[model samples]
Target: MSSAAKRKLYLLKLSPEGNASLLGILQHPDGTVLKQLQPPPRGPREQEFYNKVYDSDCCDRILLELREYLPKYFGVWSPPTAPNDTYLKLEDVTRKFNKPCIMDVKIGQKSYDPYASAEKIQQQVSKYPLMEEIGFLVLGMRVYHVSSDSYETQNQHYGRSLTKETVKDGISKFFHSGYCLRKDVVAASIQKVEKILEWFEGQTQLNFYASSLLFVYEGSCQATTMRLSDVTLAEKRRVPKGLLSGGDVLEYNNNIHVINSTENGKIEASVGKGLSKFYALHKKSCSKRHHSQLSLKVENSEQDNVWKSSTCITQEHLNGNVLPQLEKVFYHMPAEPKESAKVEVRMIDFAHVFPSNTKDEGYIYGLKNLITVLQNILDN
Candidate 1:
């Protein structure tokens, strides 16, 4: 069936709540989600990046090494109904990573564009002196703006604004308190980031950088994965709108696997019941004939061997199995018994990447800030 026609059928069968909660509108037979975005300047750029950078044989050595930190790229789709819109079919990270609670954030200054105008250039130079020294700052870190999956909406609940501090705070909270990542994983992730920066600096033909980052937390088996709640760092007022085609629209998808909402006054006691109810509802709703068949294939992304890779730093070389210093106070006491636990932080949103003329100052600035933020989260 045509994509547009499918959407009309979805609207008729799904309830108001179900429609709002739906995150996947065009699930490929292979299980990848098809995201369609309007003709923004960044849309075509993003489509090009996926086609030529990740999937193409541009920089296989470096990109393959850093693949763990990126979303898997399938191909592109151009629906006849929306000629102006660009559709990118990508491996749904949530499904690929086993429905982990995800968080999105922009690392650098959003308003200050170094190359836009003279005033902006001066402002950036004065604002990011340290970034100039680092030699690797991205142009403008825009998570919500470029991604079709992330809708354009004002954040209200978390903080009615989006800024550097808000983004950092959101990231810090997720790493320090929200989920308990192993000390080795944390150290390895930092090393990977540093290596990626070095690779970018060495590149001659193509300069790669990310405006936004995504953190996916694969909670323990016992932990409930709330598939409809990955909130933006700014705590978006409403979930970011997903792919929209005619009457059919895919809602945002997020999994709140770590912390369950408070209920009947006792938060801890309510978790079990809430999980039961969620799963029960999911099974019942999915059993309906109208629903699209959910697809979950065994993912072989670079992350599968991230910990086992010999090139990166090993766990034994770092601190022992005990949690890092920050974990003692911030992390939950007696951390949840996670079976096959995995946590990853990867840079995403490459639509705005442009060749740097004024040295790698902007790119360096963003990278240094991100590394520092991540390190601080790990150490203290």
Candidate 2:
């Protein structure tokens, strides 16, 4: 099997307080840098110094806003630091809130049993007042080995041996099945566990669906493994077909149908392209009345300009060019209508590269414009 066929998985769990800490880091001026800093000393003096430096009024405001914005399913906990690196008990936070707050944990292994581990975790966390229950979310990635037999079978099925189309189809099917399984089973399980955690957090009075929107990553190694297992089971259940006399005629007929369909698709694509070009060429020659009618038709046929603009900005990054730069400026402008109140700006490619100072500046400007536009939209 190729190295690409191997799989790996990782799982993460976060309590409400842990999440708040993370959000605090994200919102801070030097958030990215601060994450690399070690926890403060465990002594009272150290704690006081750390608080003086990092815990400003702005931090309190952000924390309050976060409490309101964040989902309530997770629990929160806190403990003061000591100089010796020993921390205080979470009981303090629990006492202040007049409720239980569970600790957040993350654990994973390549061949780990998630269910058994989750059960163990639930047992361990039960010692806390508000943490009698716990939940686990799992994420994984896996690579499947396309055996020589399956490759030959796929090639025969398409009447061409392992072509680009066959490989594309196989990979697409693999990813689709993996994604679906994660959403249906793993995500549902996470929600179930979170509900158990919430119940322990003194949210017993509130009613919630078992499958509420608990966060779950769609792509992971574990999801891939589960998907592969399912696929293997399905393959095992398949009955092999027996060759019969006079099969040549049937095979020929199927080949002809396939060839015809391929030809038809090519013809359709060519025709569509030709028509698009023709329309574009003649569109400018129309009379004012015709142009007005065309404009109305176009307007009705396509999404509104605002939506188009928003989508376009999201698809591309700002490069200090006129269009994106203008968008960045305009995003800071306040607008009317609550829906348009928030500006959506896209500048940095978060996935591909680390954001530079210039990109950060662009993002800030874009956010400013977005807020301004939203304000205008709301006022009008």
Find the candidate with the highest TM-score and give its number: 1
Across 1-380, the per-residue lDDT of candidate 1 in tens digits comes to: 23211111010112323322222234444555555543665677677766665765666674465465666777676545444434577665555332243454444434234235687667655644433333323221111211122211111123222245554444443332111233443455566567656755655444333355555553221211111224321132221222111233322222122211233322111122222333233333223233122222121224363111101111221222322221111111122223233545566666666654343444555667778867876675
Q: Name model 2 segments beyond 4 Å from true.
A: 1-62, 68-83, 87-380
- TM-scores, all models, native as reference: 0.47, 0.16
Rate residue 22 of model 1 by lDDT: 25
lDDT of 1 at 257: 23
TM-score of 2: 0.16
Q: What TM-score does candidate 1 reach?
A: 0.47
lDDT tens digits, residue span 118-172, model 2: 7655553442212111121111111121110010001111211223223223322
Summed backbone clashes in each candidate are 7, 37
Using lDDT as the measure, the top candidate is: 1
Q: Residue 356 in candidate 2 has what lDDT?
A: 23
